[model samples]
Target chain A: MAYEQSVYLTGDHELVEEFGLLCYQAGYRVTGTAHPGPVRRKLPVFFRKSTLVPRSATVAMELTNVRTDLKRKNLKFLDGALPKGALLLSSSVTVAAHEQASWIAHPERLIGIAALPTFGGRKLIEMAPAPQTGKDALARSQAFFTRLNKEVAVIQDRVGMVLPRMVCMVINEACFAAGENVATPADIDTAMKLGTNYPSGPIEWANAIGFHQVTAVLEALYRDLGEERYRIAPLLRHFAGGNRWWET
Target chain B: MGTGIAYAAALASMDALLYDVTAEALERGFGKLRADIRQSVEKGKLSPERSEEILSRIRTTGALADLAPCGAVIEAIVEDLAVKQELFRTLSGICASDAILATNTSSLSVTAIASGVSSPERVVGMHFFNPAHIMKLVEIVEGHQTSPDALAAARGLAEAMGKKPVMAKDTPGFIVNRVARPFYGEALRLLGEGVTTAEEIDRIARLEGNFKMGPFELMDLIGIDINFAVTKSMYEQTFGEPRYRPHIIQQQMVHAGLLGRKTKRGFYSYPP
Candidate 1:
């Protein structure tokens, strides 16, 4: 019998559920645990976490929403718990792959990916490798997404990767336009769709993707790149803080 | 743009005065207008008699004075501020004081064009996308002195012409151009950084994001020269705002004359 490929996904309950389904679609067995709040306030992952990843798990994924969470806690814990030579995929939308690698005991099996929530339907998956990633790990990153039936876009290691930065930047501008009363959300959406052929209105798209991710990426870009252009729009901050431009 | 706007207006059952300085220009506008409406008639979008009626409703002229009788004159002339201001100044003198004056400018400020013209409140922006007869959206922009009455009039006119009008303050690029800049700028930044090839980025944008066209493909469709100019103007008009900064790649591409479809070269190659 062919060996089964199993994945261990850890994150918020909603995100883990969403990713686990994606893994199932790719015909991989998935087990996940709901993270216990933030590491700043909680105990170690092994102490408070109830679900333990099985030894046969070949892929370990951490879907922390922000770069800081992975930097401060998730990477070290995943590095310690996963079996030797198992591939590690960490969400690196706000942090570069290399920086995340610095947190692990063995960074050779670690690679960075931008597999955001609700991305199960996307036909492309973006990946970047840290300096310490082994050749097999890089190959596995490619094969892993290939199993998901997505074309892998391996790009230079950078904060926010490629699509995340571009999409989030556009959404940031839309937030500024909306918050300034430049036009109503509906009209703004109509203009973009009719005028520019955007997939969706930037304002509404941001809301659909959840504003928290947008704000997180912008903050990371600003912090990492140190460029004023990446600075978060004040209006976007408000939206990220438990407000919706419009309901899904 | 003016020809399409006139076609849209005439099809909406309004009499339109198509104005230009040269007789040749006026004739060319009329010929294109006839060709466009003929397609509509052939497509069964309009009856033959209606197309003919719409054709006849558009009267061409070599004199600006002919627009004096128009209830609303929408100028889709060259996008130069001084020239637009002068033209509006002359038209305001010739037309009735209450007549509405609208510009089809997509880049320049509505307030700047309305400046020095008598009754600035009557001046507004009626921005129509390319192929104005087909696109449904129009931005009804209010300049500094634009009045509520003028805005309502433009809004009503846009609706009457079968266009969905959106309101915006007279900011740079209005709504569409300004907010849409990041699509091109960020793509250029990514490509410059060697993050990925244009083809891969475009593919990702289509398959992953569901956009109709990737940023590079869209830029190629809209001439690189034109897109660069819009970006530069937005940056300048925003007083050197960091977010609206024009990418260096755009400047280099324009200098190399690798302008999209028109030149048959851009971010990607076209064999033809």
Candidate 2:
């Protein structure tokens, strides 16, 4: 178990930067950080993954928003020169660990972790490991999270994992219900908070986590599972696409 | 459920006639209600005199006619649609025409329960969460034929009982139960998939998500059998939508008689 003490972090999303900072605060030496600008639209396939980090590092954390394709593209590039014994924890809330790992030759080394926008303030890491993930890799992943003083729930490799999947879908449903005039956003939020004892209403939760990310998780789940249950509410998608429903 | 509703009504200063199938069953309900109010008094949440006063307001009876003079008759019985329909039909015939007939049902359709009654508009759903006297939220669900007056009356009753009432259509699971499905379903599915232990999920939800209780913890407190039944009902009502689908893990737990706190066993074991 020769785990590296230094970690290479990539991606420009706030989640990525915050996660990197969490690792640093947890005492891991972060060697490099990469904020690939708008790579989702250009040079996605031609990028050299090796040039993004020091070759000596044994761990790389890839953090991206719900644009799962970008994570998949990064995994494909890293497949060529993925260091031996190195682990890749991709911050993907929508894509399944198995699906993302499929792009890499060593799927056993890939784990998908749900990085909520509020994750930096918390001490829990929601982990989803690919089916092919080896016991050593799983243990090493757990060790990484433990080092951050974070409790870990290594869930089955599924899209959206547990909390994010459930929460995002809740937000989507609220958006749908609001669109149909079933209830107002405030009413729905209040009903959920008072009715079910949820910590926050779905719409307010979306506001905190960013509506763009909520819609992204739903869209990815719909695309990956092809289920009507995962369909994004048109209202949520509209809001995510620069259409503001409120002053905020 | 009947005892819970009776307790809530008693605490609200409403004289309640608790009717059950037999004298023995009604006595048992009374015993539980007494113990609950006593516990509250012991905890200083309720004064002993007030507990006694609340208890004095409740009268137990096995006769259907005993409920005839009440302004509101809330039925909390078996969850079967047929059973509920028959009961509501009988209550509609026996009670005053203007009296509100509310079903304390979590899953069955309020409209269907009212369909066989004489005036379907008088029937509505007053859904109370478990341990009704403690949980603050009450769902006042409107059936298809439910009159606005009936809805208002039910809401008023909930408010009078010091409960927060949320209006919902007669949709499956109403608002809370329907929206809360994923919380338990996803957690159980993750456990079945061996992605994480139930303890881990529970810990993360409480500590990280700041939930009052973890999914597994709440399920255990609510009773696995009760939760599973709600899931099955929602799935059936939703036409087998994947979201409301019950996990096999929970079904297996229920089958094994691991029905949560009542059974002293569930996702986590409890000391008897």
Candidate 3:
């Protein structure tokens, strides 16, 4: 009998683990954890280079780390391990999926998923395809996510995508205000919720997403776009560096 | 000018005293308050007996001296710095020393407003949004000389009025207006760059950002002229920071008298 098809999930990021569990629960055979190195060579022979490329096997990677130096290196390492013709869905919050895929051998199979790791179970997801990404690759990505019950928004390839880019800027501005003592963090949060009817205050939202994560995206944008608006606030850097200075 | 504050206080079951320059103005404000309460009763939002009791707690007068017996006196007058300074100066002498003197100014410096008074420490910014009885936010602004007691009292009063109070420094634009600049600025940039149309951007923003309204749609509801004015002041106050800079498109819209729903013409026109 032909082996039941399954996906090989591999990555060391929190998002990788979250996505793996999500796929498993949805009844897609998933193998691997947040760190898949231990089982790297022990994968079922079905997912290896055999005469048949398991039609249902897909590789999902987490490129959540915003540091381009580290992100590029990790993605390059993953590239050598990527099985030929396996649709690759990579996560990149501040780097364009196209840029990440450019260095890969099968660029046509790479699709980028942009959504906060904290927002699991969220109905909406943003997908960006590289220039070389094929129609079949894009369609397969959409079908994979739709089965997981996510509504995807296919947008132009861009750093930070839409929501993360906008949300990070909002949080960065709030940090500047907070650093200046213009308002207490609690009040800053309340003002946003009450004034703009935002789901939550920017400060509180930052805490939820982690200031480290927010600064990562901002710094990446500032580096990539070189815009003064994307500059990271000094206070955020200080807090992110200390990690223990502020309450989450 | 103090009508909205008094209306909110009265609705919260406090004995609110409303004052203005003339009895006609006071009567007009009181008339509006009555109509609002009657609407609430008609909509089944409030019982008639409760509405009448709320209205009974409100008193109207033209004399500033009539505020002498109040625990807190809030000013919601014209946006002139000098006029507000002059009023705070006089109220500092009449109201009891412990009475919390508050200004509902949206953009003026609270520290500057408090400077002219002897008890600057008692002066605080109790900014309430338009249709104060309905909107829930009341920014409790602490001027440079604002005493801890004054901050506590302002926060207490905000809570008493059933409003959520966020403590802010006496900085220009405070929190909401300052932090929310990009919501408009970036949207304008995208529109100006021909990065999709306003309607498409709005649709994407609602779908992706989960906002109740799109940026352009909210700007229209808020009145483009009013939104532009705030953006202009924030840019000016920030010493030409590029982040707060208002787009020329917004400026041109204001110049063309397309001031949104108020003028029936803005980024998008409304039928008369």
DockQ, each predicted model: 0.67, 0.36, 0.46
Supply the DockQ value of model 3. 0.46
Point to the candidate with the largest TM-score.
Answer: 1
- Per-residue CA lDDT of model 1 for A114-148, tens digit only, reads 75555646888788898888999999788888887
Model 3 Cα lDDT, one tens digit per residue, B87-132:
9999999999999999998988899999879999999999898778
Regions of candidate 1 where Cα sits further than 4 Å from its true position: A1-3, A12-14, A35-50, A70-72, A243-248, B38-50
Count the clashes in each prediction: 0, 3, 0
Among these predictions, the greatest lDDT belongs to 1
Instruction: Write the candidate numbers in order of decreasing lDDT.
Output: 1, 2, 3
Poorly placed runs, candidate 3 (over 4 Å): A1-12, A32-55, A59-61, A77-85, A246-248, B22-25, B190-208, B263-272
Better of 1 and 2 by DockQ: 1
- lDDT string for model 1 (B1-272, tens) is 89999888887888888989889988888888788778888999889998889888888888888788888999999999999999999999988877899999999999999999978999999999999988999999999999999999999999999999999989998899988998888888888888888988898788778888899999999999999999999999989998889888989989999999889999888888
Error of 1 at B238 (Å): 1.4
lDDT of 2 by residue, A1-248 (tens): 34356676665455655676676666555644344432233222212233555676567787766566676676776655557888888876767777777778888888888887776568677887778778888899998888888877766676676678767877877787777655567767877887778999888998888787787787777776677777778889887876777543
Rounded to one decimal, what is candidate 1's iRMSD? Answer: 1.1
Regions of candidate 2 where Cα sits further than 4 Å from its true position: A1-12, A20-60, A72-88, A96-111, A128-147, A173-184, A226-228, A242-248, B270-272
Model 3's lDDT to the true fold?
Answer: 0.77
